[model samples]
Target: MVKSGQVSRQAGNNLASVMSRSVAKDVYTAIIEFVTNSYDADALIVKVQYNSIDDTLIIEDDGTGMDQEGIRNFYRIGDSEKIRNPFTAKGRRKIGKFGIGTTLLEYLAERYVMETWKDGKKITVREKFEGMGKGKGPEAVIEDDPGHISGTKITCRGTRFSKTGLDISALKKVLEWQVPCLPDFTVYVNRKPVSKRNLAASCIEYAFDEVIKDLGNVSGSIFYNKNDSEPLKATGIFIYVFGRSVGNPQGFYHLLPPSTVNRVVGMISADGLDDEISFDRGGFKQDSVKYHAVKKFISGVLESIIQDITYSKQKEPPRDKTDEIKEGIAIALKSAESELNKSLVNADGNINKNHPYRLELLLDEEIPWISRIDPKNNVIYINAYNPQLVVYSSKTNPTSALNVVFLTLAINALAEDQVGANNGNSDLFKRFAQTRMEVAKRLFSNFTPIGHYLKQQQGNDEQKAIAVSDVRLNPYRLYSIEDAAKLFGRDIDAVTRLYMAGTLRSCVKRRGIDRFRQEDILSCMSKIEGYIEIGSVSDILFPSDHESEGAAKHVLVNKIIDSRGNKPEYLKNVGSIAPLYFVKANNVEEFKRWYNGVE
Candidate 1:
């Protein structure tokens, strides 16, 4: 029969355990750890001094020092007494579990001296490790003093490095990196207060603060350096938890795109990550759930920072009329999709599933970048503040100038997919200038215009898509069939179907183009219509590399039928027209409910 009892380590085992964690290469870590111990002891000011002549390093703190019994407790290695109640008497947050700082003294020098005073009594200890002798445990010399100051002073002598002891400059840098900013506490080296570098203030930063569903808040600012200076090269995202650096800085780069990592630097601070700290306080326990949660949140914020950085590149506002020029480009881009799709899409037709459509006109003076393709989000970001574009905006049509830039970007989107598909080994872009020009010529010869969008606002109408107008009762301006789709946020396919089904009646029809009143387009868009394209729906729920379109559609269709007990409705000429299954849903959740077979 066995009974529960006090668990304990045999003599010298605890000391051996702590010494095993002490790294010989970095004696500075031990110094930082002891300084941290001082901070935990509610030290307001810690002073460090080193004598090059004697090779002696001393750290003294005005803190709640310990007596003879307390000195004995310090050797009780694994049993960190402060951890039982990890806060000071005045309620300062303590650096918990208290780092095993003293064991490192043995690695740094042959002799260690400690003097402390508490409760009107004093104790002095001169200690040595068996590792430097024929012993297996620590050997110590103890003495009792009548009185002393209320603080602890540690002295390390008998240098390990016989040649030119530690450099002050190098020591300061190491401590700055290892030690965190203690609240209301200061550390001094040779009477000079050592301060941390202000890496965030060195560059223009984008600040962000977000809470993950009221769980906890993470705040940070991301910095960008266009210069690629050597000083900034070593920088990336750094995370802090409880005033201590966590994980690794390089770990942040692994979570972002390759293009965004080079010039990015950030500092993130989060709370509630204490449980993840390792037994030795070397770093956080990477496999801990808290660490993963914090990382996942930071990953989302980094994506936004990337977008902001890209936009920040544009320094001039759009000299051209933004909406009109965008409308013209929108028309040109639609006409050029087939050419772009040859490269932008795969055979399975999975990527860019939502669209190779839509261009966002955010050409402000504060914005930068002539053209940027976000193929993942299916957006083409452009800075339309160009002289040529401004000149063309005055014309009844700006298709020429607009297509010159927009079509080129569309091709770049295609190249992105092609390059990605070929595993990045194609020499198609070797003679970049000639190849691009030739490709542009071939794609442009087949281009055609779709509609008009440059017009003043008109009277409001309650409903649209009600009936065909006589071009007279038109309170809304006329728009091309393509323009109607663009203005109302409907896809070209959606607008076309609504038109064919007589829900969107065009007032003017001439030469292959049908023009609709804005009122009618509005009504059509306002109609509660929902669609589920197999590839599109698959992209929605399972964004990453996921199930095949056919397999996904079968499951979705069965789910809808079984749950709603109603067969899905398909458009007439579904095979010839767009491959979409329709359902009646007034809201997004309702549409998702229909597709997912959820009530």
Candidate 2:
């Protein structure tokens, strides 16, 4: 026989018991969710303070303060009212769904407190986990404080953090990497603002804005003119990384390659018509986002962008627009796929093979209307700029998307191959790596510069540079059957038959011949494309172990003769390429004679 209030207390205990378990997973995830909510609220300033020693965390945001009803709707568990409205003053679509982020703090800590205000009214909610549970301690307080500012302050006490100590460096790195775009926002640890190296400027901040303005497509503009004395205005893309604003993206184009470090192949942003790109778990799977919604959102922005691009090409007639539109569509699709893949991919480089996605052209309009790539993670980021979808890819090619997917797969496969390539190394794996790097380089070169820079900064500078170089090489450009046959010392029919039968090796033999063919033996011809191959010729020249003298005398001579000194700058810029080429070609004698100035 329990008293009436005791019976109610029993039910409350059960609810509190379950609530405790609810916040059990990753603590950082809770922090991320709260920060995301702040971003969605158009909060320009979000301060996060945490002390591992005390196991305490504090998050403050200068976003639109929530009143009593708003707090009730937002703070109350299982509330969906905020998401249902679907519109913020900042034009950010909602991402929060369960309204359980607040409880998560308490789950991680012994006590959680939230103080917020809206329309001059302030409210506070405090929860404690001691007695309200089955055998636990006491009750928590949820209040409304009139003196609170027009913002929200979340404080956690007695928090159980995973790490032994506060990893301020690692935390700063993560935050900087995660929110590279929102430079105006700041993150501080122990009252000290974390510093990050700014990476690159957004393309939208570059000529893209000018392009947009020139095209007169000002439907939902996000870029604003800055008073900075810089010649270029800020494009809508966010290129800052680790609390530092990225340098001009254009400067990186020639210096970095996509496959190197963390490459910024391009910048993209969604137009105002879609949900903001932020980490949230509503309307998406756990720890993931809805792929279709994202795609539709991106497609709408792309369609609008294509309109601007088309208008830029005013000299072109409508008769030729079909092919042009197809080209643009292909570019957009590839970029979209790449961006989505990279965003959802994990550090382990594993991809869910069974990713759900679909794309459809909007009424033969040459622009895809509905595009969706379902993510397994429930986190969706609500971005401030919903239009002008910015997409990054290996270049704007249909194959780039496939490459991104396959590249992740290959990374996993290679990791497995490393265990089994005990028979020395996997020839197939090497070829695959080479091919993938080549493709990645090409993509990075044409797509944008950030990816290349990222890769370089991550220490694979040489490899990434090669990849960027290959972008312009058009390695896919091969001679016609007839031309190839001639170069292989065979007839067209024989070459075609051999190629079809996959027996080209039998048809074309290279035994003890320094040159693959007579054309290969000839002096360098003056062709613009030759410059690309010449630039990449180093891979074929000099040995990895050759001394500088041996390299210069052997490789440099042949390149000069082969290139006919067509590009004099190569003499200074890539002298190594010249020397290496001659040495590897077994043209040492020819090189020596030329170098010695002998007839």
Q: TM-score for every candidate vs. truth?
A: 0.47, 0.36
List clash counts for every candidate, in order. 8, 74
After superposition, the stretches of candidate 2 with alpha carbons farther than 4 Å from their true spots are: 1-24, 131-148, 194-599
Best by lDDT: 1
In model 1, the Cα lDDT at residue 485 comes to 46
TM-score of candidate 2 versus the correct structure, residues matched by position: 0.36
Candidate 1 clashes between residue pairs 3 or more apart in a chain or in different chains: 313-368, 314-367, 314-368, 316-365, 317-364, 317-365, 464-523, 465-520
Segments in model 1 whose C-alpha atoms lie over 4 Å from true places: 1-18, 21-25, 132-147, 161-167, 200-202, 208-215, 225-234, 255-264, 315-599
lDDT, candidate 1, 1-599, per-residue tens: 54699776465445553564453336666676788888877888899998878788889998988866667778765567776777788677666464356567676667778878777676777766555334445444545555666789988788565475677777676566556675577888988887754552224445556676534777765666554433453366677665555555777777666866776777677767766777655667868776777778777767666664554354223545545555555555554454454545464554554464445333333322334455444555444432223332245556555666666765554565467456763344434534644454465444421222321211112122222232122232345665554344444544554565466777764332466655666565545334332322322353235422322333344334444444434421122222223433223345454444442
Q: What is the lDDT of residue 391 in candidate 2?
A: 29
Candidate 2 per-residue lDDT, tens place, 140-170, comes to 3455555655678888888766355557666
